[model samples]
Target: MLPYKNPELPVEDRVTDLLDRMTLPEKAALICHSRMTAGPIGDLPGDLFPSSEELISERGITHFAMMAVPDPVTMATWNNHVQDLAAATRLGIPVTLSSDPRHGWASNPATAHSGGGFSAGPEPIGLAATDDPDLVREFAAMASAELRAVGIRVAFHPMADLATEPRWARISGTFGEDADRAVRMIEAYIAGMQGGTGIGPDSVACMVKHFPGNGPQAGGEDPHFAYGRDAVYPGGMFEHHLRPFDAALAAGSAQVMTCYSIARGIGVREVGASFNRELLTGLLRGRFGFDGVVCTDFNVVTGMEIPGVVSLPPRDWGVEDLDDVAKTALVLNAGADQLGGESDPGLVLAAVSSGAVPAERIDEAVRRILRDKFRLGLFENPYVDVDAAAKLVGASRGRELGRRVQARSLVGLKSAAAPVAPARIYVENIDPVIAAGYGEIVSAPEDADLALVRLKAPYDKREGLLESAFHAGSLEFPAEEIDRLRTIAERVPLAVEVYLDRPAVLTPIAEFATVLAGGFGADDDLALDVLTGRAVPPGVLPFDLPRSQRAVEESRADVPFDTADPLYRCGHRCPRA
Candidate 1:
């Protein structure tokens, strides 16, 4: 290893000098870290988030990405930690803190800063439903302010994946099932988050994700967990998926993330795009000509080791069949700028020392990281106010837009006026305060004479996102919980609204309820409109809902739900007359 000497040099020189000094262990350490992993110096949880102090340290770690934390103040604390770390680090390198996209109040750890009270504003489906480009831009810009105010610089969001399947759990999180809509929203999303020029001292950078089309996963399963492998684009039909990434680059997406799922038979290891050359260099850099920071989707390397103990299907990609050293080699060769999750940087250093990877490659990655910090003005000034970080959260203009988007994205599946006799309504899982804004907010389903029964929740069961993440699949409802819903539906003409995340069967409610609606996210306004017969359902089934595990398996890969003899054909929206 070379000696470290260029202390006063520019970012580029310092990066080169720093790389020259680091041993393999230290370099590998830079690439891997657990989200919110509490190390000796910082205090955090084990959900793959990072502390601010860890970011600014001169310990040769520049890329700091955090996932799965769901709070704003906690997020603020995390950012403040980064700022302090930057100030205290020997090199004073302000950490480039990045998130998956917490635009809405969902505060999904993937996108938003982790912790309490962070708003999970609305799902991306809401933006596409509005079909208003200008509005989309406004929303993005608003969201940018919100993100920046909280001390985060980059957003790992605007998932450009075309939601072509109804069964895909990540669909509600995307723009929609259309490529064009996704592309347009990508532009708007990037513009909103990255465009505001220190306007009122707020503006978050954007990171367009799941590059080169992650929508084609054989089944609707997300690549994040196991079982969700094979993103087959059959004969380069993948052009549609690339559209959004192109548009995002043109619109100035500061950074781009790789997909964890496997792509067709090509990179069968389910290796993330972060380490895929076809995705990073061939497509993004070679074709699109994007010269920005390139980071991996979180914990991708470590994820390969996961055996996906969390995901349902026990599976293995072909890469695991190859030599372990070669596997990590492929990722580094693929052009990943920075490693993600709690990966060990040792893989990267070993690849370098053993001559599997060229020193130039590692240097290039470091350059990109430095370039981003430079652009962010971190080199000039890398600190943020702590008090301000807390104040700015949930105060951005994008929050309302999130609600509107959620309302607009809703698609009424089943609505019936059959034997109907009521002007008002009420429900659980919904705050009457939020409900009243859209329509009647009642406290009693029985008193209303007609019940618009909507399951306003993430899953049909009450398992939280964190719990479900670990559970993977095999998710089921307890008998006590099922009994309560059964009794209520049987007594009233229930308008059963269901949130279609994974394949949630509502045979119980269907037995007694009058209506069933999918895609019930946070806001109930849009669902409310559909129930009241104000908004006609235009949503098509993104994927087929398998009645049984056997059906889900037997279904075709491209179009999983065959219309010939499927439980629910694609585009099967039961509209009101």
Candidate 2:
């Protein structure tokens, strides 16, 4: 066996053996992280891109991020087939499969996918609301096991970025707005995902994301769009944002994904964190000493056009004018190890051929990437057991734990003196069948003894398919909806629960709600269980509940707890009845 394929050799020696043998094209392919859709053994869907076999053979690509969540048996079979393709390659480098967080309820195609066959739980914000590091660690450990079952070796999760900006669309993925709490949670998360001893056969490498922090978006807009490209630090809390990442590194996180926003007023160049040399190299590598794989946020090298719905521009940010090859060169020069969401290895090859990017830089990136694959034990056995995957993917224990956590993460904003078990209950945005389990499901509030209302935190509808997925814009409910809610509250006592994807201006809802609760990626059954007092919610506010839209606008996006007269402060929780 070759030194690189030897399981007993040191990881460094294995990496060196592989790096020395790799060609320029192979090296370029190793650094370009692309996406793949799951399908049957020989027939894989590409949506709009090339097939998995074509990418492996023609492009020489070995790294892929999975976009969909199929059943365990199918996923495992697909993964094994892909590994077989990689094995047939010139170097036979094992394919490393990565995925966005697939255990959560928040289903944004651009960010996180829904828990299809995995244990379904609350979003990261729900975990933050619970304020328990042990629980976070447990969740990560469970998730790691499930991921490894289907051959997914990397987790693009434990989003260490703080939800400092209440209006930010990606807040659901973060650990609230506090630096200290986020640091603690992140440390525990990394420890759990990496199985405490660090990346190994049983471990799923954690790619703690949006380095230097992605939460302080200007106007609370996401950096994914052109309008939301600027990540401004008005409160000068740039260093504060790095706290969780510092903790992640300390806890042995295996990878880091840079944000897409053009960071403004933080001393570095006004470009996306992935393209900025000072931020990626000087700060992340130099000051913090993070030597792990540094991957760019998806599609930083080129703009993507999603047919007729929307023409999404490339998030090159400050370097928008540069060609795809130049942008690829710039990202490598800035010290990133991989170009995520990019399929074309030609960009990397062209950059090297034109002498704009040095071959040594490509080698440096390949070494880090190879080292991680080796540490993950992918070199020894890349294929997962198809039969074992079905039995292990979503075990009963993990599902029960997820259900319990979903209930526990529900924050009680207002509580009744005792659990209200009304004979007749009216419901909205809640399953009537589930409501019937607690009490008689009524047609209207007037006919019922109590009314149960479930609401999603309000967001103005955007035009595109991808744009609409992000729940951005206003946080306030429409005036008509508020008036409708008020009418119901006047007729019958109202129990209101809002899914706090982003911090909503809940002052009006508070006035009418007899019992107000906040949820993060919870199901109707879980929400109703807490509402009817079958389950006890022990969560607190992860972030401040801003009083109004005006207050949210006035608050600094970069600073936590800056809102004037918030409805509830961070960590606020009502006493359990």
Candidate 3:
């Protein structure tokens, strides 16, 4: 047996032996990660989407981006099956499975896959609202264990991007607006996922994402769309956004995922972070001393015409004219170790042969990839027990922790006289069965002593295809909705809670509601717990609530807390009596 095949050998020696034995195609495969579905194992026919067997045997791929987390038994079974295929390959390089954050409350399929059997928790914003670094760490640790239980070794999470820009569609996935606070949260997050011992076999390596920070998008548009590609800095505060990433690196994040947005007007080249060598190589690598693997955000190398997403266009931002091969070359030259959302190694293989990208560059990328696999102890035993996985995922302790954290994340923006215990209650957008536990389920506002209304933070509705799904555009609530909320307040004492995906203009509703609350991806029970005084409202505003849309428009996109006369400042919360 080769040295790489010997589990007792030092990881460095094993990695070297593996790299030496790998073919050019195999090396290329290591540097790119393609998407994989979790379910009963079957072949997915596409150039980009291939079955686990095809990915290992034919393509020589060793990394996969996973989604739609199935039951733990199914996931573990599928993972073990994939491992078996890799075991049959020449090098037997085990697959490093990765997934977006799965436990978030406002889980966008684009951002976080469903929780499946895992404990569902608040979004990053909600967790940050609690202002508890220890809680964040606990959640990350629990999430890490759940991820590892199902045979996933990588957590593409702790999205350290600051929610500086209020309208950015991805803000719900972020820690919040303050750089200092975000840095602290990020450090705790990395430590939790990687563990105190650092990223070893027991740990699920965290990919601190959208490096250099993905906040500060121009007009609050996300980079997933061609129209939203340029991430501008009108206040010239680009370095301010780097605080969290810098802290994350110091905390020893195992990987960095570059964003799709191009840094415009920052004296840097106007190219996507994936295509910009200066940002990826010079700033992140040279200046910041990040030696970890840098993976590109999804679909940077190829054009994707997603069904029902005609409006987004392709995410090729700066190098739109480049062919797939050239795009692959550019991404590699920019120092990205892996092409996320891309499966086909042929483009990279062609680029190397044509001398568009050097073989040494590919070798360098593969070394980092292989080292991570070795560090994860995948070479020793890549398989997991399905029965064990079933028991571990969504374990009772994790669910209890999740529940406590959820209750702690509720921020009371305003406080009023508490409704008497067992008072008649009218609830909207809440499960009636759950509301019944709190009080009598009244049929009308007139019959209720208190009306509880839950609203999503306002977004300007977009037209046609893809834009409609994102919570972007305007931040103001519709007039009719506000009027209705006001009417309810007139009839009965009202408690209004906003599910804040982004900072909303809430002056209208705030004026009318007797009590105001805000949270991110919280369950009805948690909110009710806080409302009924069963749990204290321990959360504070993670980011400032702007007074109006005009303030949001006038504020610099790159700076936190820049909105004029914010209705409620960061850290503001109504005190418990």
Candidate 4:
């Protein structure tokens, strides 16, 4: 057997030998990670681009970011089949599987998959609300075990970008606005996911994201569309945003992903971080000393067009003038080891043939890729036991822990004079059976002693297909919704539970409700537990609740704790009974 295949050999020796044996096509395959949807073993969904056999056997692609798997056993079987395909190649290199966050209730296909067949609980923002590093560590550790049980080696998560801009659509995914608190959360997160030994088959390698920081989008616009492309640093607080990533690196995160936002007014060239050599190579790789795999966010090389529905031309933010080959060369030279969501490796081979990219640059990228796989022990054992997957994934103990964390992470803004176990209760968007356990369920608000209402944070409501999906635009509630809440409050004492996907203006609702609680992707049962004093609420505000929309507009996009006259300040919560 070759030295590269020998488990006993040093990791450096194995990586070096594998790099020498790899051809340009093979090397390109290692550096390109494609998107896949989970389904039956050896069979892929129709929506997925490029067939499974074509990518693995013909293109030599190995890394896959899987989404929408129905169950644990099927996911494990699919992984085994994908690995079997890679093993059939001439060199028999094993595949490394990755996944977006799938342990939460928020199921955005592009961002996070549904926690169906796995532990489902509050999102990361909820974890931040707890503000307990020990709890965050425990959550990540359990999540890591479940991910590895299903053959997922990489966790493309712990979105470390600070949620400074309250209107940004991705705020629900972050550790919140305070840099120091986010830094502590980052350390605990990496520790839990990687464990003490770090980056082994037993560990799930974490890809800490949006390097240099993705928060502070100008006017809270996302970088996904042309309208939301600018990231202005008016306060010159760019370094403050980098604190979480710095903390994550110190904790030994194995991978980092660059954001799509094109930065402006802060020193380096105003381009996408993925294409900016100074930011990716000089700042991150040079000053920060990040030698781990640096992957692009998604689809930087190819432009996407959905025809009348949603059209996103390529995300080559600074270099839109350049063609596809030039763009590919620029990304490689900028120090990106892998292209996320890109299926074709031939584009890279073409760039090398045109002399647009040096052959040595490919070697550097492939070396990092091979080293990560070797460190993960993928070559020794890539297949998972399909039967054991169901037993291990979302095991009873793990789910119970997730529930406890969910209960602990609920933040009560205002509590009623007494516990909310009224004789007659009217509930909206809550399980009727659960409410029955506390009081008699009634249909009319007038007859009920208390009215329980659940609502999502408000947004401006963009009309375009893709634009509307992202919760961008105004952060204030509409007049009609505000009126409705007022009417409900007038009829009966109200208990309002608002989902803090982003910081929202809640002055009107606060005025009416006898009790108000803020939740970040938390379940109704947890809210009930906190209200009835069955469990003590253990969460705090991860960010400030602006008094009004005017305050949010006045706050600088790049600065944290800048909002004035906040209704509820960061780290503030109603006292426990």
Maximum-lDDT candidate: 2
Please, what are the lDDT tens digits per residue for candidate 1 over residues 258-324?
A: 7776676554334456556777787788888876666666655544332323432212243555444
Ranking by lDDT: 2, 3, 4, 1
Model 1's C-alpha root-mean-square deviation from the true structure amounts to 6.2
lDDT of 2 at 353: 95
Error of 1 at 138 (Å): 2.3
> Where in model 3 is the C-alpha error above 4 Å?
43-48, 305-313, 463-466
Instruction: Please write out the lDDT profile of model 2 over residues 395-473, one tens digit for every residue.
Output: 8998988887787789999877433678999999987777788888889889988888899999989988789899998
- The residue-by-residue lDDT of candidate 4 on 1-577, one tens digit each, is 8999999999999999988998889998888888766677555444435667888999898998885677898889888888889999999999888988888767665677766488866788888888889988998899888888888999898888999888899888898988888888888988898894368877888899988788999889888777777888899998888889888888899999989989899888888988889999999999999898999988888865434445556777878898887888889989899988787888899889999889999999998888889888899999999888899788898888888778767888877664446888888989998878878989999998888888888988887666677888787899998898798888988888888889988888888888788888767788876655456667888999999888889999999988898999999887663
Q: Candidate 1's C-alpha lDDT?
A: 0.57
> Which stretch of 10 consecutive residues in model 1 shows the poorest summed lDDT?
306-315
Q: What alpha-carbon RMSD in Å does predicted model 3 have with respect to the real structure?
A: 1.9
lDDT of each: 0.57, 0.88, 0.85, 0.84
Stretches off by above 4 angstroms in model 1 are 1-34, 37-58, 67-74, 105-115, 196-203, 233-236, 265-275, 303-316, 321-326, 396-398, 413-428, 431-448, 456-467, 470-492, 502-520, 524-577
In angstroms, the error of model 1 at 255 is 2.2
Error of 2 at 215 (Å): 0.8
Q: Name the candidate that leads on TM-score.
A: 2
TM-score of each: 0.75, 0.98, 0.97, 0.97
* lDDT tens digits by residue: candidate 3, 1-577: 7898787888889888888988898888888788778778764334334567777888888788886678889999989988988888876788888999887776565677656788978888888887899998999899999889888889888888888899999888888998888888888888999996357888999898897768999899988887788888888899888888888889989999999999988888888899899999999999998877999988888754444434234478889898899999999998899998888899899999989999899888988888888888888889998898999889899888887788788898887766767479999999999999989998899998888888899897776555666789999998898888888989988887889989999988888887888888778988876555565577878999999999999999998899999999998977662
Better of 1 and 2 by TM-score: 2
Q: Which 10 consecutive positions of candidate 3 have the poorest summed lDDT?
A: 305-314
